[model samples]
Target: MNNNNALLIIDMQQEDGFVLEHFDSTVNNIAALLDTARQQRVPVIYTRHINQADGSDMPRGEPRAADGGPSSYRAGTRQVEILERLAPRADELIVDKGRYSAFHRTDLDARLKALRVETLIVSGVLTDVCVLSSVLDAFALGYHVRLVSDACTTTTLAGHYSSLLIMANWVYALEILTCAQCLHALCDRAYVSLAPQQPDQFAHQPHELENTIARLHSHLVRTQE
Candidate 1:
Protein backbone atom coordinates (compact mmCIF):
# COMPACT_ATOMS: atom_id res chain seq x y z
CA MET A 1 0.00 0.00 0.00
CA ASN A 2 1.25 3.47 -0.83
CA ASN A 3 1.52 6.28 1.70
CA ASN A 4 -0.84 8.29 -0.46
CA ASN A 5 -3.62 5.76 0.14
CA ALA A 6 -6.54 6.65 2.36
CA LEU A 7 -8.52 4.31 4.59
CA LEU A 8 -12.28 4.67 4.12
CA ILE A 9 -14.37 3.34 7.02
CA ILE A 10 -17.83 3.12 5.56
CA ASP A 11 -21.02 3.03 7.62
CA MET A 12 -19.98 1.17 10.72
CA GLN A 13 -22.34 2.85 13.09
CA GLN A 14 -24.57 1.85 16.01
CA GLU A 15 -26.29 -1.56 16.21
CA ASP A 16 -29.36 -0.33 14.36
CA GLY A 17 -27.13 1.07 11.65
CA PHE A 18 -25.34 -2.20 10.92
CA VAL A 19 -28.09 -4.71 11.84
CA LEU A 20 -25.80 -7.71 11.69
CA GLU A 21 -25.48 -10.63 14.12
CA HIS A 22 -21.71 -10.56 14.01
CA PHE A 23 -21.47 -6.81 14.08
CA ASP A 24 -18.99 -6.72 16.91
CA SER A 25 -16.64 -9.02 15.06
CA THR A 26 -16.55 -6.74 12.06
CA VAL A 27 -16.15 -3.60 14.15
CA ASN A 28 -13.26 -5.10 16.08
CA ASN A 29 -11.18 -5.72 13.01
CA ILE A 30 -12.02 -2.40 11.45
CA ALA A 31 -10.86 -0.68 14.62
CA ALA A 32 -7.67 -2.69 14.48
CA LEU A 33 -6.96 -1.49 10.97
CA LEU A 34 -7.80 2.07 11.91
CA ASP A 35 -5.26 1.84 14.68
CA THR A 36 -2.58 0.86 12.21
CA ALA A 37 -3.69 3.58 9.83
CA ARG A 38 -3.34 6.12 12.61
CA GLN A 39 0.05 4.85 13.70
CA GLN A 40 1.30 4.98 10.13
CA ARG A 41 -0.07 8.49 9.65
CA VAL A 42 -2.25 7.30 6.77
CA PRO A 43 -5.14 9.53 5.80
CA VAL A 44 -8.37 8.15 7.28
CA ILE A 45 -11.86 9.09 6.18
CA TYR A 46 -15.04 7.97 7.95
CA THR A 47 -18.20 7.96 5.87
CA ARG A 48 -21.46 8.41 7.78
CA HIS A 49 -24.80 7.18 6.43
CA ILE A 50 -27.23 10.10 6.04
CA ASN A 51 -31.01 10.14 5.51
CA GLN A 52 -33.85 12.20 4.11
CA ALA A 53 -36.89 11.44 6.29
CA ASP A 54 -34.73 10.24 9.14
CA GLY A 55 -33.70 7.32 6.88
CA SER A 56 -30.72 8.91 5.14
CA ASP A 57 -30.27 12.69 5.16
CA MET A 58 -30.09 12.87 1.37
CA PRO A 59 -33.78 13.15 0.51
CA ARG A 60 -35.56 10.83 -1.88
CA GLY A 61 -35.70 11.93 -5.55
CA GLU A 62 -32.51 13.80 -4.86
CA PRO A 63 -29.32 13.31 -6.88
CA ARG A 64 -27.89 11.05 -4.18
CA ALA A 65 -30.59 8.60 -3.16
CA ALA A 66 -29.80 5.71 -0.87
CA ASP A 67 -31.65 2.42 -1.27
CA GLY A 68 -32.33 1.80 2.45
CA GLY A 69 -34.50 3.83 4.72
CA PRO A 70 -32.81 6.36 7.00
CA SER A 71 -31.00 4.24 9.52
CA SER A 72 -31.76 5.32 13.11
CA TYR A 73 -28.06 6.13 13.44
CA ARG A 74 -28.08 8.68 10.64
CA ALA A 75 -27.31 12.34 11.35
CA GLY A 76 -28.91 13.53 14.61
CA THR A 77 -30.09 10.07 15.60
CA ARG A 78 -27.98 8.15 18.08
CA GLN A 79 -27.76 5.45 15.45
CA VAL A 80 -25.60 7.61 13.22
CA GLU A 81 -22.84 7.80 15.76
CA ILE A 82 -19.75 5.90 14.69
CA LEU A 83 -19.39 2.85 16.88
CA GLU A 84 -16.95 3.52 19.69
CA ARG A 85 -14.62 0.76 18.58
CA LEU A 86 -13.66 2.43 15.31
CA ALA A 87 -14.59 6.02 16.03
CA PRO A 88 -12.65 8.71 14.24
CA ARG A 89 -10.22 11.03 15.95
CA ALA A 90 -10.33 14.82 15.61
CA ASP A 91 -7.90 14.94 12.70
CA GLU A 92 -9.79 12.50 10.49
CA LEU A 93 -12.42 13.55 7.99
CA ILE A 94 -16.04 12.51 8.65
CA VAL A 95 -17.86 12.40 5.33
CA ASP A 96 -21.64 12.49 5.16
CA LYS A 97 -22.92 10.29 2.36
CA GLY A 98 -26.50 9.50 1.39
CA ARG A 99 -25.65 7.01 -1.32
CA TYR A 100 -23.73 3.74 -1.27
CA SER A 101 -20.74 5.22 -3.04
CA ALA A 102 -18.91 7.73 -0.89
CA PHE A 103 -18.07 9.73 -3.99
CA HIS A 104 -21.70 10.10 -5.07
CA ARG A 105 -22.97 13.59 -4.26
CA THR A 106 -20.28 13.77 -1.62
CA ASP A 107 -16.90 15.44 -1.62
CA LEU A 108 -15.08 12.21 -0.73
CA ASP A 109 -13.21 12.11 -4.00
CA ALA A 110 -12.31 15.75 -3.68
CA ARG A 111 -11.09 15.27 -0.14
CA LEU A 112 -8.96 12.29 -1.12
CA LYS A 113 -7.74 14.06 -4.19
CA ALA A 114 -6.79 17.05 -2.10
CA LEU A 115 -4.84 14.72 0.14
CA ARG A 116 -3.18 13.26 -2.94
CA VAL A 117 -4.59 9.84 -2.18
CA GLU A 118 -4.44 7.46 -5.13
CA THR A 119 -5.61 4.31 -3.38
CA LEU A 120 -8.48 3.51 -1.02
CA ILE A 121 -8.69 0.84 1.67
CA VAL A 122 -12.38 0.07 2.28
CA SER A 123 -14.22 -1.58 5.19
CA GLY A 124 -17.82 -1.63 6.41
CA VAL A 125 -21.07 -3.62 6.76
CA LEU A 126 -23.51 -5.11 4.26
CA THR A 127 -20.78 -6.64 2.16
CA ASP A 128 -22.86 -7.11 -0.97
CA VAL A 129 -24.53 -3.73 -0.78
CA CYS A 130 -22.82 -0.62 0.57
CA VAL A 131 -19.33 -2.12 0.58
CA LEU A 132 -19.52 -3.47 -2.97
CA SER A 133 -21.20 -0.37 -4.30
CA SER A 134 -18.60 1.94 -2.80
CA VAL A 135 -15.66 -0.19 -3.91
CA LEU A 136 -16.89 -0.38 -7.50
CA ASP A 137 -17.34 3.37 -7.55
CA ALA A 138 -13.87 3.85 -6.09
CA PHE A 139 -12.45 1.64 -8.83
CA ALA A 140 -14.23 3.60 -11.55
CA LEU A 141 -13.13 6.88 -9.98
CA GLY A 142 -9.50 5.82 -10.52
CA TYR A 143 -8.57 4.78 -7.00
CA HIS A 144 -6.97 1.42 -6.38
CA VAL A 145 -9.46 -0.39 -4.14
CA ARG A 146 -8.57 -2.78 -1.37
CA LEU A 147 -11.42 -4.50 0.49
CA VAL A 148 -10.75 -5.52 4.08
CA SER A 149 -12.65 -8.80 3.99
CA ASP A 150 -12.66 -9.50 7.72
CA ALA A 151 -13.56 -5.94 8.54
CA CYS A 152 -16.77 -6.08 6.53
CA THR A 153 -19.92 -8.08 7.32
CA THR A 154 -23.36 -8.79 5.87
CA THR A 155 -26.67 -9.85 7.37
CA THR A 156 -26.22 -13.24 5.71
CA LEU A 157 -23.18 -15.45 5.22
CA ALA A 158 -24.12 -16.27 1.64
CA GLY A 159 -24.19 -12.62 0.58
CA HIS A 160 -20.92 -11.91 2.36
CA TYR A 161 -19.09 -14.81 0.73
CA SER A 162 -20.66 -14.13 -2.64
CA SER A 163 -19.40 -10.55 -2.66
CA LEU A 164 -15.89 -11.71 -1.82
CA LEU A 165 -16.01 -14.24 -4.65
CA ILE A 166 -17.11 -11.64 -7.15
CA MET A 167 -14.54 -9.09 -6.04
CA ALA A 168 -11.69 -11.60 -6.16
CA ASN A 169 -12.71 -13.27 -9.40
CA TRP A 170 -13.53 -10.26 -11.57
CA VAL A 171 -12.34 -6.96 -10.10
CA TYR A 172 -8.88 -6.46 -11.53
CA ALA A 173 -6.56 -4.34 -9.36
CA LEU A 174 -9.19 -4.51 -6.62
CA GLU A 175 -7.66 -6.70 -3.98
CA ILE A 176 -9.43 -8.64 -1.20
CA LEU A 177 -7.39 -8.92 1.96
CA THR A 178 -7.82 -9.75 5.62
CA CYS A 179 -7.68 -7.03 8.27
CA ALA A 180 -4.40 -8.52 9.44
CA GLN A 181 -2.78 -8.36 6.01
CA CYS A 182 -3.90 -4.78 5.57
CA LEU A 183 -2.81 -3.78 9.05
CA HIS A 184 0.58 -5.35 8.54
CA ALA A 185 1.00 -3.69 5.17
CA LEU A 186 0.27 -0.29 6.65
CA CYS A 187 2.36 -0.83 9.78
CA ASP A 188 5.19 -2.65 8.03
CA ARG A 189 5.14 -5.26 10.75
CA ALA A 190 4.65 -9.01 10.85
CA TYR A 191 2.40 -9.33 13.90
CA VAL A 192 -0.62 -7.10 14.22
CA SER A 193 -2.34 -6.72 17.58
CA LEU A 194 -6.06 -6.59 17.08
CA ALA A 195 -8.27 -4.30 19.12
CA PRO A 196 -10.85 -6.82 20.27
CA GLN A 197 -14.17 -5.70 21.70
CA GLN A 198 -13.48 -7.57 24.90
CA PRO A 199 -10.50 -9.30 26.43
CA ASP A 200 -12.26 -12.67 26.13
CA GLN A 201 -12.92 -12.42 22.39
CA PHE A 202 -9.61 -14.06 21.57
CA ALA A 203 -11.34 -17.08 20.03
CA HIS A 204 -12.52 -14.91 17.18
CA GLN A 205 -9.00 -13.93 16.12
CA PRO A 206 -7.77 -16.65 13.78
CA HIS A 207 -11.21 -18.16 13.23
CA GLU A 208 -12.46 -14.91 11.80
CA LEU A 209 -9.32 -14.49 9.69
CA GLU A 210 -9.46 -17.90 8.04
CA ASN A 211 -12.42 -16.92 5.89
CA THR A 212 -10.95 -13.57 4.72
CA ILE A 213 -7.26 -13.54 3.84
CA ALA A 214 -5.97 -17.10 4.21
CA ARG A 215 -6.84 -18.03 0.62
CA LEU A 216 -6.24 -14.67 -1.01
CA HIS A 217 -2.50 -15.07 -1.60
CA SER A 218 -2.91 -18.29 -3.55
CA HIS A 219 -5.77 -16.80 -5.52
CA LEU A 220 -3.78 -13.65 -6.26
CA VAL A 221 -0.70 -15.69 -7.24
CA ARG A 222 -2.66 -17.78 -9.74
CA THR A 223 -4.39 -14.73 -11.17
CA GLN A 224 -1.08 -12.90 -11.53
CA GLU A 225 0.47 -15.64 -13.69
Candidate 2:
Protein backbone atom coordinates (compact mmCIF):
# COMPACT_ATOMS: atom_id res chain seq x y z
CA MET A 1 0.00 0.00 0.00
CA ASN A 2 1.05 3.59 -0.56
CA ASN A 3 2.06 5.72 2.38
CA ASN A 4 -0.57 8.29 1.43
CA ASN A 5 -3.37 5.75 1.95
CA ALA A 6 -5.18 5.12 5.23
CA LEU A 7 -7.81 2.64 6.41
CA LEU A 8 -10.93 4.31 7.81
CA ILE A 9 -13.11 1.99 9.91
CA ILE A 10 -16.43 3.74 10.50
CA ASP A 11 -18.98 3.02 13.20
CA MET A 12 -18.02 -0.57 13.98
CA GLN A 13 -19.29 -0.16 17.48
CA GLN A 14 -21.17 -2.50 19.81
CA GLU A 15 -24.58 -1.03 19.06
CA ASP A 16 -27.74 -2.53 17.58
CA GLY A 17 -26.50 -1.40 14.19
CA PHE A 18 -24.64 -4.67 13.73
CA VAL A 19 -27.68 -6.89 14.03
CA LEU A 20 -27.73 -7.91 10.39
CA GLU A 21 -26.88 -10.72 8.03
CA HIS A 22 -23.17 -11.37 7.50
CA PHE A 23 -22.30 -9.19 10.50
CA ASP A 24 -19.94 -11.79 11.93
CA SER A 25 -18.27 -12.36 8.57
CA THR A 26 -17.92 -8.65 8.03
CA VAL A 27 -16.26 -8.24 11.41
CA ASN A 28 -13.85 -11.08 10.66
CA ASN A 29 -12.95 -9.59 7.29
CA ILE A 30 -12.41 -6.17 8.85
CA ALA A 31 -10.10 -7.75 11.42
CA ALA A 32 -8.07 -9.28 8.58
CA LEU A 33 -7.94 -5.91 6.82
CA LEU A 34 -6.68 -4.29 10.02
CA ASP A 35 -3.94 -6.91 10.31
CA THR A 36 -2.90 -6.27 6.72
CA ALA A 37 -2.84 -2.53 7.24
CA ARG A 38 -0.61 -2.96 10.30
CA GLN A 39 1.72 -5.25 8.38
CA GLN A 40 1.97 -2.73 5.56
CA ARG A 41 2.58 0.18 7.94
CA VAL A 42 -0.65 1.86 6.83
CA PRO A 43 -2.45 4.17 9.24
CA VAL A 44 -5.78 3.00 10.69
CA ILE A 45 -8.53 5.33 11.99
CA TYR A 46 -11.68 4.27 13.81
CA THR A 47 -14.95 6.13 14.30
CA ARG A 48 -17.57 5.57 16.99
CA HIS A 49 -21.08 7.00 16.90
CA ILE A 50 -21.95 8.59 20.21
CA ASN A 51 -24.69 11.00 21.22
CA GLN A 52 -25.15 13.33 24.15
CA ALA A 53 -26.17 11.92 27.52
CA ASP A 54 -29.63 13.43 27.14
CA GLY A 55 -29.96 12.52 23.43
CA SER A 56 -30.12 16.16 22.49
CA ASP A 57 -27.27 15.75 19.99
CA MET A 58 -29.08 13.23 17.82
CA PRO A 59 -30.56 14.40 14.60
CA ARG A 60 -34.25 15.25 14.41
CA GLY A 61 -36.54 12.29 13.61
CA GLU A 62 -33.61 9.91 13.71
CA PRO A 63 -34.25 6.16 13.81
CA ARG A 64 -32.69 5.89 17.26
CA ALA A 65 -36.14 6.36 18.71
CA ALA A 66 -37.45 3.32 16.88
CA ASP A 67 -34.48 1.24 18.06
CA GLY A 68 -35.55 1.55 21.69
CA GLY A 69 -34.47 5.17 22.30
CA PRO A 70 -31.81 7.82 21.77
CA SER A 71 -29.87 6.56 24.79
CA SER A 72 -28.17 3.86 22.77
CA TYR A 73 -24.99 5.78 21.95
CA ARG A 74 -24.74 7.69 25.20
CA ALA A 75 -21.17 8.77 25.91
CA GLY A 76 -19.04 6.23 27.79
CA THR A 77 -21.65 3.58 27.18
CA ARG A 78 -20.71 0.11 25.95
CA GLN A 79 -22.85 0.54 22.81
CA VAL A 80 -20.60 3.32 21.60
CA GLU A 81 -17.39 1.35 22.06
CA ILE A 82 -15.58 -0.15 19.12
CA LEU A 83 -15.71 -3.90 18.72
CA GLU A 84 -12.94 -5.64 20.64
CA ARG A 85 -12.05 -7.86 17.67
CA LEU A 86 -10.82 -4.84 15.71
CA ALA A 87 -9.59 -2.65 18.53
CA PRO A 88 -7.40 0.31 17.67
CA ARG A 89 -3.85 0.48 18.92
CA ALA A 90 -2.64 3.16 21.32
CA ASP A 91 -1.15 5.18 18.48
CA GLU A 92 -4.16 4.82 16.20
CA LEU A 93 -6.86 7.50 16.10
CA ILE A 94 -10.41 7.15 17.43
CA VAL A 95 -12.81 9.85 16.26
CA ASP A 96 -16.12 10.17 18.10
CA LYS A 97 -18.98 11.19 15.87
CA GLY A 98 -22.61 12.17 16.44
CA ARG A 99 -23.83 11.68 12.89
CA TYR A 100 -23.89 9.07 10.17
CA SER A 101 -20.92 10.45 8.29
CA ALA A 102 -17.57 10.34 10.09
CA PHE A 103 -16.50 13.60 8.45
CA HIS A 104 -19.55 15.40 9.74
CA ARG A 105 -18.82 17.30 12.95
CA THR A 106 -15.43 15.60 13.37
CA ASP A 107 -11.78 16.39 12.72
CA LEU A 108 -11.48 13.45 10.37
CA ASP A 109 -10.69 15.53 7.31
CA ALA A 110 -8.14 17.68 9.12
CA ARG A 111 -6.44 14.66 10.64
CA LEU A 112 -6.25 12.86 7.28
CA LYS A 113 -4.84 16.00 5.70
CA ALA A 114 -2.26 16.25 8.49
CA LEU A 115 -1.18 12.70 7.71
CA ARG A 116 -1.04 13.61 3.97
CA VAL A 117 -3.54 10.92 3.09
CA GLU A 118 -4.92 11.11 -0.46
CA THR A 119 -6.78 7.84 -0.54
CA LEU A 120 -9.07 6.29 2.08
CA ILE A 121 -9.79 2.56 2.40
CA VAL A 122 -13.21 2.47 4.06
CA SER A 123 -14.72 -0.46 5.99
CA GLY A 124 -17.43 -0.78 8.62
CA VAL A 125 -21.08 -1.36 9.60
CA LEU A 126 -24.37 -0.14 8.12
CA THR A 127 -23.11 -0.04 4.56
CA ASP A 128 -26.23 1.86 3.49
CA VAL A 129 -25.86 4.48 6.20
CA CYS A 130 -22.58 5.49 7.80
CA VAL A 131 -20.36 3.81 5.22
CA LEU A 132 -22.18 5.37 2.28
CA SER A 133 -22.36 8.77 3.95
CA SER A 134 -18.66 8.80 4.77
CA VAL A 135 -17.72 7.64 1.30
CA LEU A 136 -19.64 10.50 -0.31
CA ASP A 137 -18.09 13.06 2.02
CA ALA A 138 -14.61 11.73 1.35
CA PHE A 139 -15.22 12.02 -2.38
CA ALA A 140 -16.48 15.57 -2.05
CA LEU A 141 -13.40 16.39 0.06
CA GLY A 142 -11.18 15.41 -2.91
CA TYR A 143 -9.95 12.11 -1.48
CA HIS A 144 -9.92 8.89 -3.42
CA VAL A 145 -11.97 6.06 -1.86
CA ARG A 146 -11.50 2.31 -1.93
CA LEU A 147 -14.31 0.39 -0.22
CA VAL A 148 -13.88 -3.14 1.11
CA SER A 149 -17.16 -4.70 0.05
CA ASP A 150 -16.72 -7.84 2.13
CA ALA A 151 -15.76 -5.91 5.23
CA CYS A 152 -19.06 -3.99 5.34
CA THR A 153 -22.69 -4.97 5.89
CA THR A 154 -26.12 -3.35 6.18
CA THR A 155 -29.49 -4.29 7.64
CA THR A 156 -30.33 -6.17 4.44
CA LEU A 157 -28.55 -7.65 1.46
CA ALA A 158 -30.33 -5.25 -0.87
CA GLY A 159 -29.21 -2.31 1.20
CA HIS A 160 -25.61 -3.46 1.16
CA TYR A 161 -25.42 -4.11 -2.57
CA SER A 162 -27.44 -1.01 -3.45
CA SER A 163 -25.16 1.15 -1.34
CA LEU A 164 -22.09 -0.18 -3.10
CA LEU A 165 -23.65 0.35 -6.50
CA ILE A 166 -24.79 3.86 -5.64
CA MET A 167 -21.36 4.87 -4.43
CA ALA A 168 -19.72 3.41 -7.48
CA ASN A 169 -22.17 5.06 -9.84
CA TRP A 170 -23.92 8.17 -8.53
CA VAL A 171 -21.75 9.27 -5.62
CA TYR A 172 -18.24 8.74 -7.02
CA ALA A 173 -16.14 6.26 -8.89
CA LEU A 174 -14.79 4.19 -5.99
CA GLU A 175 -12.67 1.10 -6.22
CA ILE A 176 -14.80 -1.69 -4.76
CA LEU A 177 -13.08 -4.97 -3.87
CA THR A 178 -13.33 -7.80 -1.39
CA CYS A 179 -11.23 -7.81 1.78
CA ALA A 180 -8.96 -10.54 0.42
CA GLN A 181 -8.31 -8.66 -2.82
CA CYS A 182 -7.74 -5.44 -0.92
CA LEU A 183 -5.20 -7.12 1.37
CA HIS A 184 -3.45 -8.68 -1.59
CA ALA A 185 -3.29 -5.39 -3.48
CA LEU A 186 -1.97 -3.58 -0.45
CA CYS A 187 0.61 -6.13 0.68
CA ASP A 188 1.95 -7.36 -2.67
CA ARG A 189 4.36 -4.79 -3.97
CA ALA A 190 3.96 -5.81 -7.61
CA TYR A 191 0.17 -5.90 -7.43
CA VAL A 192 0.05 -2.53 -5.70
CA SER A 193 1.85 -0.91 -8.60
CA LEU A 194 -0.53 -2.40 -11.19
CA ALA A 195 -3.86 -2.15 -9.41
CA PRO A 196 -6.33 0.82 -9.64
CA GLN A 197 -4.62 1.49 -12.98
CA GLN A 198 -2.90 -0.52 -15.63
CA PRO A 199 -4.15 -3.86 -14.31
CA ASP A 200 -4.35 -5.11 -17.88
CA GLN A 201 -0.71 -4.25 -18.49
CA PHE A 202 0.21 -6.80 -15.85
CA ALA A 203 -1.37 -9.58 -17.90
CA HIS A 204 0.48 -10.97 -20.94
CA GLN A 205 -2.51 -11.69 -23.20
CA PRO A 206 -6.22 -10.98 -23.62
CA HIS A 207 -7.24 -14.38 -22.20
CA GLU A 208 -5.08 -13.89 -19.12
CA LEU A 209 -6.57 -10.45 -18.56
CA GLU A 210 -10.09 -11.79 -18.98
CA ASN A 211 -9.45 -14.52 -16.43
CA THR A 212 -8.09 -12.06 -13.92
CA ILE A 213 -11.11 -9.81 -14.30
CA ALA A 214 -13.43 -12.80 -14.03
CA ARG A 215 -11.80 -13.91 -10.80
CA LEU A 216 -12.27 -10.49 -9.26
CA HIS A 217 -15.89 -10.38 -10.41
CA SER A 218 -16.54 -13.79 -8.89
CA HIS A 219 -15.01 -12.68 -5.61
CA LEU A 220 -17.23 -9.62 -5.46
CA VAL A 221 -20.37 -11.66 -6.17
CA ARG A 222 -19.49 -14.25 -3.54
CA THR A 223 -18.81 -11.58 -0.95
CA GLN A 224 -22.22 -10.06 -1.52
CA GLU A 225 -23.85 -13.48 -1.19
All models: lDDT? 0.71, 0.79
Steric clash count of candidate 1: 10
Question: Where in model 2 is the C-alpha error above 4 Å?
Answer: 63-69, 189-219, 222-225
TM-score of each: 0.75, 0.82
Superposed by TM-score, candidate 2 places the C-alpha of residue 180 at a distance from the truth, in angstroms, of: 0.9
Candidate 2 residues 29-74, lDDT tens each? Answer: 9999899899899999999988877666778876565444575777
Among all windows of 10 consecutive residues in model 1, the one with the lowest summed lDDT is: 193-202
